[model samples]
Target: MAPVPLTVPRRALDIVVALALLVLLSPLLLFLTVLVRTTSGRPTVFRQQRMGEGAREFTLYKFRTMRPDATGPGLTSGSDPRVTGTGRLLRRFALDELPQLFNVLRGDMTLVGPRPEPAELARRFPPEYQWMFRHRPGLTGPCQLHSRSHAALLNGMPDPEEYYLSVMVPRRAAMNAELLAHITLTTVVRYLARTLWYLLSAAWDRSGGSSGRPGGDATRRTEEGRSLCVRS
Candidate 1:
């Protein structure tokens, strides 16, 4: 599939909104920084090498949401032990990702686009999956919300790079391409609203309410098995 060209107007809008969001959220960012420091013990921000448009490498930013030593390949199950108490709160509310606003301002990312994958994962995927490189990576995208479980499966797999390329990446790339084709200010606004709602809902559920467990453990386990297949 060919890369979709970004319209000039859309690009301009992206710049304007990204800059405005950074400025408007500065106080929130500061507050989060202090909270993370007190809770996670310094290094409030985490950076990782991620693939961007044209398969370029860039350092993606996020508020640290895992233990300082919790580095390695594994799926982040709801019950992952590595998630600190405050980290769980941050993840549930999506507050941990607030640092990526800087990525948008840096032009390495867009507010609405395909979420970038770690460069190692990108390298493992095939060329077709590489189509994701056609557009800037995003802080949030279609796949981010709808495919959380699938993403967890992919990320947890032994050869996730291959599974992502063979399965998830192609499908998500298509969705992202479609989104790019229909990009507009109204659509972007709607996407943001939906994403915010989803985050809030998840947070609400986590706060002593119903667990929005989308699938049964059996189903999740099946997906996990498939993830293992990519390696075998």
Candidate 2:
């Protein structure tokens, strides 16, 4: 086999963690799947083609957060009218992304790396940024940790897709390249830890658990995750 950027140990870790998470998160996944079905009416899981390792394409899954018939631009802000109420909650904390754990199990992705581009948008990605296809796209990574910030920027855009390709994509490409350049066991571990914290914090906030104060514990934890993304 060709030597992929993902090392043997990293792949081992990915498999172990992915399996454990699938087993542990199964109940929550079931609940969410049912919730989406009941709330949005069938097709609980959304499937889309995404660009992956070596520029290969594969189906990525997410717990559906939009109406079964909703159709519009792929890039969505929190305010996208197509998003259902359940989906708004799901998107706020990224609960919609939980299904990608299966993608990790199936070797379509790793727990960490650059976020994948939509297959259709892959061509729009600048040729210079094409290097991102080297490794399997990650379930989460450095650039991905800044998703909320990017989404906020996107929310106000006259054209989310244009701003994404022209603005966010360059930043994402740079962050992805930098992280890959210095990838190490320590780097991977840090990313995984930060991701865990991010998920937990986001979930809490979305669940109406956020502290209502500026410098409260919840905000502090979120801020810490933001800082760690810069230096972790």
Candidate 3:
């Protein structure tokens, strides 16, 4: 199923929330933009094609974390060599994604929906998982909330891309489908609150490198997060 309709109310909420966020976070956004520009050189904001609703393609924006001239596999774990010091911190705390609020304002995305899959990754999804494209992609969702943990897992993988496509992709599709199938206002609210907490809490992690990989408190928190959104 495509989930209950949130067309009118959801779009309204997305606009109100997105605009508020953009305004409130403007200073930090400017700082990060300048930070990336100075360190990585021009084009501080990274733009790439991501799959949207109905498999349509649209440009997704984020602060550039990798070297501007980087030439490596597209799928990267946080620990990848191409990631800059600023890039690593931005990725760790998800400050790089603050620009995606613009994506929500533009109607290319929603505040809560499936994580926008890359075109290549979406193309490789199994037939059963194709239903995920029925809705616009999200700034945050079930899969997105635990992205840190997922990145941590990918860090330990010898072949991250292949493992992600083979294991993580299908798992995410199923989890996202389940949540969307029963989505509601409260579900959306919980997700947004949880996402904020997840992002803010990342600051407490003192890991010099790596995404605070799964272990001890990290594992517990990941499990707690997973349990939060998997329910109706």
Candidate 4:
């Protein structure tokens, strides 16, 4: 299948859905903002430069999830001490990413597509992944689905930054290219639904506080390790 063009209809669909979600989720967004401010101190939002379509740079927004004084490489590990208490909760269900709805509204992103890479990472990507730059970055995508969450991916890694750069980036880029090639309305809806399911599952786990999922983290880490090894 050929890659889906960024047609007028697709853009319109993004705008309408993004606007509706922003309106519907406004209360939760406001509450999260206040919570982040009170818990993490001022500067509730974290904005970083990310590469988008045609390698354009744009400010990607998320609820601040790390301490202001924390200093380290850009990559975050499962045991990173910089992640705050509230930040952990926010990240568990990916609530920190809610701010990107505004980006979608502003036309910097889509609800489903290749997740945007940081500017530095984008500059280092191989030519095989260059096709991703032709499309608007997305809040969720095939790469995001296939890969483990940040905690799982970085678990027990000797060097999280190096592991991510050397192993994860290229794998995700290839998946993103594959997703872009066969992208359709049905594919987009499937990806969105899967993302929502994961979010809900994470929320349930958080609420239950480890009812029956013993050793879940270890199992996930093992799976992630195997996945990475397979590609290696």
lDDT of each: 0.63, 0.70, 0.71, 0.67
Residue pairs in collision within model 2:
none
Candidate 2 whole-model C-alpha lDDT, 0 to 1 = 0.70
lDDT of candidate 4 at residue 176, scale 0 to 100: 77
* TM per candidate: 0.77, 0.84, 0.84, 0.81
- lDDT at residue 115 of model 1 (Cα atoms): 75
Candidate 3 lDDT, 17-132, residue by residue in tens: 99999999999998997898777666566666677887788877777666654654446665666677878888788787888899999988999898887676668777877778
What digit string (tens of lDDT, one per residue) describes model 1 on residues 47-140? 6677788778887777666665564342354445556677767776777677777787777887788877766566766765677777787777
Lowest lDDT 10-residue stretch of candidate 3? 213-222
Give residue 138's error in model 2 in angstroms: 0.4
Task: Tell me the tens digit of each residue's lDDT in model 4 across 1-232.
Answer: 1233476766887889889988999999999989987886766777667778777888787777766555554555555566678877776777778888889888888878887776666676667666677778888887655433544667567766567667777777777778877887777778889988876786666332111110111111111221211222
Model 1 stretches with alpha carbons more than 4 Å out: 1-5, 151-165, 206-232
TM-score of candidate 1 to 2 decimals:
0.77
Ordering by lDDT: 3, 2, 4, 1
What is the Cα root-mean-square deviation between model 3 and the actual structure? Answer: 9.6
lDDT per residue for candidate 2 within 1-232, as digits (tens), equals: 1225678888888899889989998999989978987786666676667788988888777766656556555576545566678877776667778889989989999988988777767767788888888678888898767766565565556866777788878888889989888987788889988977876777656433211111001111121222211222
Backbone clash numbers for all candidates listed: 0, 0, 0, 0
